[model samples]
Target: MKNTSSDIEEYLVNVPEERKEAFKKLIETISENLPSGFEQGKSSGMIAWQVPLETYPDGYHCTPGSPLPFLNLASQKNFIALYHMGIYADPELLDWFVSEFPKHSSRKLDMGKSCIRFKKVDDIPYELIGELVQKVSPQQWISLYEKLYKK
Candidate 1:
């Protein structure tokens, strides 16, 4: 499930033609709204934003050598998948997103525990994602991560 490729450009080059622009826009929305201290790179075969090892030396408990993933944006076989760790771990955040989704997009949400799937692709809610990106900062994620997963 993890592509060893470190190059994000190569990852984008392979996204289905129809999904490319929207995918890129989501990336832009996240990058623009992301707070200080999280780094963007390729992780788990997707374009990801994470708290770097420098900021959180413990890394991911599931994969200690890797950065602690906050969000991962991936082009999947069936849909665009956005995996956001905060919303999965934080009840208030999850509720906020579930409530706000309808205000931003008419399509009913297709979501997993932490993964938001945009099967229609064209209807992906970029604004809501931008707001979600701003919801958790690096320190907040690290503190939450330690409490929820590092044990």
Candidate 2:
């Protein structure tokens, strides 16, 4: 099923008010910084920013059934999550991020296959995150996916 911004907002019901505001602010910041042609939408119940299908006929691999760009943002009860499909498909990028922002042995990076989870706004290095986001152009991301997935 297609996800919508309202769905994402509804899922955030359990999030604390303060955290909700912080998450919203972060989302706003990301929205403002995204390159043109990237539209805001929702997928899998998470807020997403992506290039429209008209821009990339192949569609977003992260959400294979959907035709939107695949970048995702979502909130869980404990943390806010950001996902870039390239993280799982691009080892160099993942290695660079892990090395540059080394996590302590005691505290994991709280990452899934592609998602990065932050318990609080302060937990994230905003500048580094911004740099990472900027580095992945829509076309470049598609190329990376093709190189890695061969699809």
What number of clashing residue pairs does each candidate have, in the order they appear? 0, 0
lDDT of 2: 0.69
Query: What's the lDDT for all of these models?
Result: 0.91, 0.69
- Candidate 2 lDDT, 1-151, residue by residue in tens: 2224466556456456767776776677777666666777776777888777777776756666565555787776678788877677788888877776654333447788888888756666665566567667777876776776646
Q: Pick the candidate with the highest TM-score.
A: 1
In candidate 2, stretches whose alpha carbon ends up further than 4 angstroms from where it belongs are 1-15, 61-65, 102-108
- Candidate 1: residue 89 lDDT (0-100): 99
Across 111-150, the per-residue lDDT of candidate 1 in tens digits comes to 9999999998779989999999999999999999888888
lDDT, model 1, position 35: 97
